[model samples]
Target: MTDMIERSNTPVRRRSPGDPPTVPNHPVGPGRLRVPLLMFGAVAVLVWIGIWIGNTQLTHDAFFPSRPGIAGGTWFEGWQRWDAYWYRTIVREGYVSYPGVQSSVAYWPSYPLLVRSVSWAFPSIFITGSMVTLACGAGAAVALRRWVGEFLPRSAAITTLALFLVYPFGYYLYGAVYADALFVAATIGAFLLVERDRPGWAGVVGIVATAARPAGMVVAVALLLRVIERRNLARAACSPDAAAPGPFARFDPRALRRRDTPVLLAFAGVGAWSTYLWVRFGDPLLFATVEENWGQGAGPATWFKVRVFEELRDKPLAAGTIGHVVQGLLLIGALALVPRIIRRFGWAYGLFTLGVVGLALVGTKDFQSGGRYLIGAFPCFAALAEPLVSRPPLRAVLLMLSLVALFAMAVAYGRGTYLA
Candidate 1:
């Protein structure tokens, strides 16, 4: 009995430095990615089908419609809801400012510009936009799998990918005419590039990411943290007896090389936009000004307007109240995982998650679109998936809940409900 007990406690084998890395317990090569990609594709199709069914079978609420150039009488038109209307407006009539009022300038330019570029060949901005989103979503999934696979086992990586795809607002990744997919793709791509020691390429991708959304500047900051972390790791390696640097350790200026300068390019997209806005509208920060018109801005009043408690008190079971509650819960849960994320992935990922969640919370009223915004903080999903990889029953319950929420949100979005 003693011999058997000792044998059962043996450690798993570890690969030597010279050997090619293998998926933990799997011994597979690059082909391990194939199954995850296929799973992502399958989920995308299911989300698309759910949207189509909801749009065709249910009655849509009265809401703003897409502009003339992109509107059409087709199933695809169902996707041209909510913010897609604003994007179509920008595509048809370039960003125009209306004093102290909501305007096209409030929407970022990268997504609409991509849609217009694609429309040159497709002739339908709606279809072009959806195609762009789907392509970006695919890119995001691939990068996410690769990034997680770098540290965790194959099972953990796949679990992270699955949770991200089925996340409540994840249906937006399935060809919704929104910038979320593109922003996610570029952000994850940049992180993956940074992980691979290609900071210059990461900055290039950062340009697209920053231009895609207001919260994109966080990518630049995250990259900076990663660079600093890498530098500290190198220093520690060279001095075996020296104490390892903490995540927030101070760095030497001399350590920064020419290769690090390109990280500055991460700010180029937003810089160019600011320059354009200054020249065209006479206010470089017109986007922030425009955001105020949409009932979003920083201050105590904005926090009060979140109305989470008020909604629950007034109508706890109402759909709007329920949505707000779920959004609040998700925001709290993501923030709660920040420490774990930082501990597991290092300072870059932990702080990136914090920045994303902070931006989502700071200027919003009622946490509108909070869940959707959390999609950019992909590390939270990784933090959640890592432990679950060893617990099948708990994983199943979480995935099931996520699937139900994903479908519910997709259907509501397709039916033209004002879901963020």
Candidate 2:
């Protein structure tokens, strides 16, 4: 992933045939990150204030009433809606279940566990969870910028970060007390570690990712694809003439060497959760089973029965219809970038985008939570940023639209209205 960039006014130095290949001095230091970090911090602050104002001043009929003791005690209580309630519950009382009912098991454990760990000091699940989400969101921004910088110019990386920040549903990454912020941080951090050729650390991060959400499994699969790519590159380097292995080439056990074994740890994260469920509830895969209680079941039957378009046609301006449209457009846009992402980044990223979109589609009935889920498909944003880097007007328009939608969604979320 390393590329050499010659500085302007620096003289070119020719290398001898025997000279070692020049290694790049790619230091991702404060000097390189100052502007983007400040910009991200500013946007985060604005989002916090915006949500506070919306929750305080604006009023709407709450589609889903805030749960008791879940939201509405503080200025930032607007963020403690929907899934935040589940996380807060989990923090107060560990995963509990009633027969044939939706339970805390449906929500993954890492984020709640983290919130609980810090709750001793913060003393408020809502505040502690919001702080964790904010911290993870900042980490995601940094990791995204540095990862994009590996292949693209600094301006392009900054644009990508900007795009991520204003990405419509990106408010979830700001002050929302949801697991998504941690999931994105872990997912991108793992990708960056893999790009830096640190599989062990990547696996460790993947553990956090997998423990954050069910979609976190995509990180493990993407890392496996990257591992295969590494093997193919190594083979090409060794043979020089032999054709590289096909993308679907037969599995080679030799590829799973000591360095690569850490990838198994990704599954271990989820595996541990399953074991806990088995011991506590006598069902190891209770998470998947409980999803049916939420009207989400994954299968070919589910895919064929999608009614998003029908909903749009019948009630074009309904809140749920609008959510469907926004998520549908984002899914289409991401799908459109799959090929370009593979060409620009790698197979892992392109396919990871596909996997994320696929999961979002199949995992929901009316694309519920689809928009929030697609935030994990960071590759699509990078692919978009590349072209936008040379088109300022287009970039501005996109950002404007994104910001408008972001504020609208923030207000909706603050009002306890269901939003993806």
Predicted model with the maximum TM-score: 1
Put down candidate 2 lDDT per residue, 37-141, tens digits, no spaces.
787788887687777666666674465443445433646677877788888889888889887778889999999998988887775788898889988998898
Number of clashing residue pairs in every model?
1, 0
* Candidate 1: Cα lDDT at 228: 66
lDDT per residue as tens, model 1, 1-420: 999998777653433111122442332576555766787788887787777766777777777343334344435766878888789889998999998788998888888888888888765788888889888888898889887776677788889999999998998888889999999999998887777778899899999999888888888887777766766666555554555565446244455678788877889988988899999999998988888888776667677664677777889899888877778788889999998886777767778888999888876778889989999999999899989988999999999998988887777787788777
Candidate 2: 10-residue stretch with minimal lDDT: 16-25
Q: In order, what lDDT does every prediction score?
A: 0.80, 0.78
Clash pairs, candidate 1, are: 306-366
- Model 1: C-alpha RMSD to truth? 5.8
